[model samples]
Target: MKLLTIENLVRKFSLKVLTGENQLQQTITQSRSHRPGLEFVGHFDFFPTERVQILGRKEITYLHKLSIEERQIRIGNIVKYHPPCFIVTAGQEGLTYLTQYCVEEGIPLLCTNEPQTTSEFITKLDAYMIKTLAPEIAIHGVCVNVYGMGILLRGKSGVGKSETAHTLIGRGHRLVADDIVVLKKLSPRTILGTHDGKTKEFLALRSVGLLNVVRLYGRKAFQDETRIALDIELTKWQKNSLNNELEHEPTFTEYMDVQIPHIEIQLQPGRDVAGLIEAAANNWLLKQQGYSAAEEFMKRLESDSSW
Candidate 1:
């Protein structure tokens, strides 16, 4: 979604302008080309140089106290500042200079009952801007929220990524994204996971055709978004001469500049893949809480030597 524009701001906050229609129109036309829907507040006029002249309550009062020519100079100086809008709080105080300048320049002036309310309104506007402006990236995998941790499953076409996700779903995990995972960088190190709008709930279940998970499992059984914490890869075992090591516990691997805590489970003839995945999720939880089974075993061995 695009961010709110000056017109949107006026409509949302219900602001009443005291000056500058011509200026407002010109500024809106020019800013729309760049910001599109950026919301503006208060009453202001647009200068020829594409700047807005704001007429605040204090300035209006000052204009009332000054001579006619002095008031014109004040409004001119304000236009030179090139503000996008002018805000006159509370009610009208007969600041004819400000009103005339706004009428001539066509800038928007906004009036509101309370300043604090306006502050909150602007805060929400900023939040909306950030969410809409964030960069988005897509990855080929299925993401699920299992026991409050984001788990991403990746492998070859027939390597059972969706099947594993289904298994996890059946085991009471919440599905986030099915086939294509949309990842957004929320922070420097944190990546938030979501699905593209087109495929948010659509999942391919081999023989079952397309299935709507939300329709089947209810909304609570799935999350609209989550932060990706780990990645699991499934690979077919090759009986070649290489590093052959017995699987002791879960391990990790990295990909695409992300330290995706990974585990390559070799799919064999008679392995309980679903159960293994559950155990992997539990192991990840333990690791996150600083409990390592390998480290515990080493500690036990050292203690036994003293005995």
Candidate 2:
């Protein structure tokens, strides 16, 4: 239900407002663009009016070949559809007819530099719109992609979250974010995690200062982004407490209205915390595949006569 407005695009791409300044508040629902060749030819079948109409060299050339009256009638038919906006890529000339019509009809007409080709603009703008429209939130955690699963490790400060993530990266898993993770709700159930520019490929280690994960471990040590599948919280180890019970059931955390599988691990001395995190990730993957060791164990105990 998120909306991307023409004004937002203008600010992001530095677009020139050829016309329809009042219609800058118009919203676009899709991330795709239409060439509008068929619409220009009076063929409205399968026309995507919800997306922006991109006029590149080919479409403008086609219109230039037509008589003024014919071109007006052709382009006029397209204007009747009330598209979100019309973008002229490469700053092509001879768009006065289109621009005037759009201005009079209150349709947004935008122009960009010649170096920005139609395809390049569409691809980049589409991606930007998708990300911009997604619901996002910031989380203090370390996210890593382990065994193709996105694991978000969160805890209080000095809880060994970053150390475990660093260890995981050294073990060949890829780091998605170090301290602050940005989570975008792409769908009702899917959450995508990414980091900001400043701390993307860098991890802050207490003993060694900032470590560039990509440079230290090569490209395989970092992932630009990932879809978060599990959440783990690290806490101090307790002696003979219920929190330390091995028979405790798994937990769930609600994030952006989505229920994520959660785990709580105790931090202690002489413990292989990194390996434990790896095992938790593997167990989460197993549970996703309908394999649960806890449930199997309970079923076996019930079927045994000695139980």
Candidate 3:
């Protein structure tokens, strides 16, 4: 696992570090080799040597109850602790001495403006941390990386996601995974999709059996990892279902507290599903940069008022 530094945290949250600029940056930038000790206190952990330490307003008061020497010792241990960085919730300011110690020792302090209880803050922060720190794995399925966007194909057995992926592959797009895709929630708002290393470069065609796609299609046809930008599901058409009036616009699928753009392409006789999927992918790419063809068409029709 790559330990994230405090400087990166500051950049990520757009926070202003009030003190200990130089030291905090240096301490957080270093790699963490071991896990920190955990001492649970009021929905927060007082880890002696973890890279990240969380401080609440009440926790700071609790620390003040200890002798000056003891407080110094504890703060020193945390400053030198090696998990990655420290996060302060609810914008609670620590004791002046503790803040001074943190500045001198170069320990990064992160503060959030969210006004929630300690437990709720911990739960949400932990979720965000896990997404940021978890490892990514790849699985079997057709993974398409189109113009910097990752589009995953998913559905029941024999749904045309894989076949559509193969078609995209033939059309000069890149593949990230085939069959099983290991998706990791990177943050509350982001999911990182990557190819499982042990099974990367492999795709199982329905009739042709397992094939080494990297070996057959060369390096350009495959990618080691990608951020899951969208999801497309291939489903059988239902006669009673209402078709989406918005063409070439992708929908979003929410999983594990993250929202990923997605689309459902109905499979039916005489429909060129592969071509539609490709067009969908292209249209999705355009939408990411604030262009929506369906919305544009509707705007034109509304403006004309004759159609």
**TM-score per candidate:** 0.62, 0.70, 0.56
In candidate 2, stretches whose alpha carbon ends up further than 4 angstroms from where it belongs are: 1-51, 54-74, 77-82, 87-128, 242-250, 302-307
Could you give candidate 2's per-residue lDDT for residues 219-269 as a string of tens digits? 999999988888989999988653434355767988899778888888889
Kindly report the root-mean-square deviation of model 1 from the true structure over all alpha carbons.
7.9
Q: Residue by residue across 1-307, what tens digits does model 1's lDDT show?
A: 2343455545655767566444434323222111111122223343333322233444455557777776676566655444566555435467566666656655566665555443354454444444444556788888888878888888888787787777777888888898899876645566678888888877788877887888988876679888778777778877772354433544554433446677777777787876777787788788789988778887899999998
Off by over 4 Å in 1: 1-127, 239-258
Per-prediction count of colliding residue pairs? 31, 0, 20
lDDT for model 3 comes to: 0.66
Ten contiguous residues with the weakest lDDT in model 2? 241-250
* lDDT scores in order: 0.64, 0.86, 0.66
Off by over 4 Å in 3: 1-49, 52-132, 135-141, 240-244, 247-251
Give the better candidate number (2 or 3) by lDDT.
2
Worst 10 residues of 1 by lDDT: 32-41
lDDT (C-alpha) at residue 267 in model 1: 75
Model 2's alpha-carbon lDDT is 0.86
Say which candidate scores most in lDDT.
2
